[model samples]
Target: MSTPTLLTGRDPRSESALLLLSAASGAADAFVFICVGQVFAGVMTGNLVLLGASAAGVGEHGVALRVINALVSYSFGVMCCAWMSERLRWPLPVMLLIEVALLATGAVLWALDLITSDGDRLGLLVLIAVAMGIQGRIRATPTNYFTGTLTSLVSRVTLRSRDQGDSWVAGRLIAVVAGAAVTALSVRFWPGAAAMAAVVPAAGALLVESVPRRTSRG
Candidate 1:
């Protein structure tokens, strides 16, 4: 089988969609880490470090369990998305739909004040992680983890290129940072409502994907 053309294709609409998804990822990460626990919903690499720290007895109560649940659930989501993409030809809109459903469910639970127990919180995190995993696979971009992308883009900016896509990269980085900051503030003041705010970007991504692409005539 051929490798997936995950991020090669470039268009204004696709880039906009990816930027919105990146914002959602940043917001979800901040919300989960602050409101739920000190665990990331999308950044698996950070979770691994946190899991190691928790195993070594370094953090608060239930940190280990939360990290483990996120790891396992994220892996499951990746596998599920891979299977669906391969079998169903990997429709971007369909993948976005799945992500929207999961995120919407988490938002509803948060709004309804249902995440009262440790288990409920864990379930919510897992749901968000799964949604994020599916989204990560769908885009296969560095938007969720912008640190590395930013580093690379900064390096590239020094050497001006014929196609200056670095502007888009910079825009995405700003969006992620802005989204995280906004969501962190929301979670601090309005805990339940923050989840709804996180859902907005995911919905935007879905809407962007649903629009039909225009082809050029030779």
Candidate 2:
């Protein structure tokens, strides 16, 4: 018997499925880098402190600016997803494109020293927030770190491994760890460029696997 050849097309259902998987994997990796960077740069905790200080009327304008920027950035990220869902049958490619565009934009901003010395801190925050927001929402399964919080990821892993008793828990936990390792290595070697490099595979995956005819085959 002859082996059947796999034919591909940009079908909406096939495209959507592949895109979702790409988004999930990309988001998983991005989460690791974002979390690590936030922890290292004192961004996440600082946001909380800023919130507290703002509530107490002792907050600096910078805090509020940063907060607003963060909100806007995240909103834009979510909007990217929404835009895809609304305009395209397969929203994954759009999401990947948006992510790549954002990364490129960030690179331009960085090259122009827009986020280095005396840079627009608010703008930078917004960019980071949006990127993180998109990643945080993409997940194959949720256990911990729903928003890139490693602490929660760890705790949930422990709980799920024991309670649900699923065999895949170990593999998922390993993925998280591996992701962290990649982030660390990338950051060490390429610094900010590491983040930009991550978007490549994500985009490629969507482009390669989004064969539209898969949905129609069955």
Candidate 3:
């Protein structure tokens, strides 16, 4: 067995934030896939395949453009957040607040019924994609940014402050599924709240990260 990191160094708040973040990712992807467009917001691999199919004229070209819009906006968000966080010294809470703003914008648009037209679809796609990209860029140990994709998550389960365990991985999967499930139900029954699925969880993550951890002397 690998040497365990000090358990005292762990903060349950951080783990809760991670689970909420994972749920946010899952909810965002699900809403974008269903409501915004048929393409994924964060799952770039799936979008790439859809893009190729569009180029081959397998489906409507408009779908291709939507995929491209998501890809571009997602990249832009990743680059900007990376620069500000790594180079500009922006804090994690501030970074998460930015993401929350983006998610909130998307949710408001949906709740306001502003995304009905064909042109509005692209904008919605960009908003969700950018938010997802920013969520992916958050800097925190044990947060598992890799939760964006389950396929690769199982292969790499290293935690910076805790020993690897089944609960570690299972918790993330369940969080993701729970997020997706909530979004799916909302989209099915309460379509107006489709994008709100991610917004609330994202806000929760931001709040969790914003709080100062309590200290105790050993």
Candidate 4:
């Protein structure tokens, strides 16, 4: 059997899937930052900066712990997903289901107001970080983080005036911004609802994957 091309596919469905994943990333980030303190769920680079600031005595109290927990959890998630992908044939769907389970758990915890203590909050953070880490690995296009996407977008746009790269990057950025805005607003008014809302896009991506593609007859 040949190796699967999970990422690096350029089909329309893949593009749509990437957009949904990007939106999911945005919502997850906003939800965690707002409810679980100022820690990012998906953007590890920002977490690293926060870690650095804390080390230099410039960050808020407990920020270092949050950053550390997120980093460790995300690393664990990535390692686990990588191993699973290597061993499992249906790695993409399996990873997506795992992410859904994690997010659903977080949503339940948030809804029950169980994330009152540092430990409780850390648990929530771990779930979100793990889900996002798996997402970062699964998507063919960049989804969970924007820095790399933005850099690549700039390079592509600079080299070519009108191209697929421009459209793809622009669409993804828009999706991320839109998702963050919607979820942030929801979180501001209804925290529990926002937690649940983060799961929708991931679910949508799964639905997209479930649809069978039509093949041409010779």
- lDDT against the true structure, per candidate, is 0.83, 0.45, 0.76, 0.83
TM-score for predicted model 2 compared with the true structure: 0.53
- Ranked by lDDT from best down, the candidates are 1, 4, 3, 2
RMSD of each: 2.1, 8.7, 5.8, 1.6
- Winner of 1 and 2 under lDDT: 1
Structure candidate 1, residue pairs in collision: none
What is candidate 4's lDDT per residue for 1-218, written digit by digit as tens?
Answer: 55544755387887888888888888999888888878898899999999988888886679899999999988888887877776665557777889888998898888888788988888899999999888877766778888887887787778875575568678889989888887889987886788876788988887787677788999
Residue by residue across 1-218, what tens digits does model 2's lDDT show?
33222112134333333333333333334432353222111124455665667777774444555555555666676676555454444344455456556645664564465564323544554554665455433333432232443445567777774433222434434544554555556567756554444445445544654444333455
Decoy 1 TM-score against native: 0.92
Residue range 21-137, candidate 3, lDDT tens digits: 878888988888888778888777778999999988887648888888988988888898888776777777887888889889989998999888878988888888887777666
Once fitted onto the true fold, the runs of candidate 1 whose alpha carbons sit more than 4 angstroms away are: 1-9, 159-163
**Top-TM-score structure, candidate number:** 4
The pairs that clash in candidate 2 are 9-212, 10-212, 11-212
- Provide the lDDT at 24 for model 2: 34
lDDT score for residue 217 of model 1 = 100
lDDT of 2 at 68: 50
* Location of the lowest summed lDDT over 10 successive residues in candidate 4: 1-10
Candidate 2 or 4, higher lDDT?
Answer: 4
